[model samples]
Target: MSSADAFQQLVEETLLANAAVVALVNNRVYEAPPPKGARVFPDVTFGPADSDDADADCIDGVEHVLQLDVWAQDYGRLSSAKRIADAIRKALHRADLALPDPYALALIEVASIRAFQDPDGLTAHAVISVRSIIETET
Candidate 1:
């Protein structure tokens, strides 16, 4: 698999393993939309990934900038969405993720987080930016 794909899988697995996150999203995490009300209040989505080379002479590595989005219909106060964002940060920040075979996750860091009310007014949205370093197995 590509480094980006491996890193993404690691992230999804980490979030799925977090009990607090599961309680909120109920594993309704995906790259695409799930059916409405298929799970719970807040759902997590993995957004786009931007990658660049972090390669060295002997080691081939990649740095990936990934986004995670949280959505909820909490109206005025987006407490639930905020909490879910926090959980995502906790799950990924400075984490040592494990990638699929032939790839190794060197590090993962939460770069930034932005939360805002969507134009629709009813949905609260949180976007999390994460950076990850992955190295190919020799």
Candidate 2:
């Protein structure tokens, strides 16, 4: 699989397997979907990947910059979204993700996290930036 697809799969699987995250979002994590219902609040959405070649003279690998967006509807506070974001960070940061036999995920790191109030004033949004290094199978 492409690095982006692999990275996204890793994130989705990780979040699904996290009890805290599942409790927060009601298991409503998606790759790309609009906010739908109360059960979907405190959800996570995966954004596109920005990948670059990290090949060396004797090694074949790729470095990917991935984005995960956390969303929640909370007035006067962003605690819900922040909590989900924190869980995501804890689950992914410095993680050694497993990929298909065709590829190896070497590392997953949290690059940055930024939270903001959406224009609606009731939607809490947080963008988490992550870096993943993958070694391709020979």
Candidate 2: lDDT of 64?
92
lDDT of 1 by residue, 1-138 (tens): 788887888888889999888888888788777676565557888898899989988988889999999988878467888999998888889976677778878889999999999998889999999998888876
**Candidate 2 lDDT score relative to the true structure:** 0.84
Candidate lDDT (C-alpha), each? 0.86, 0.84
What would the per-residue lDDT of candidate 2 be over residues 1-138, giving only the tens digit for each residue? 676787788888998998878878867788777645434576788876799988877779999998889988888378877888898898889976698877888888999999999999888999999998888866
* Collision count for each candidate, in order: 0, 0
In angstroms, how far off is 80's CA in candidate 1? 1.4
**Residue 80, candidate 2: C-alpha displacement in angstroms:** 1.6
Off by over 4 Å in 1: 35-40
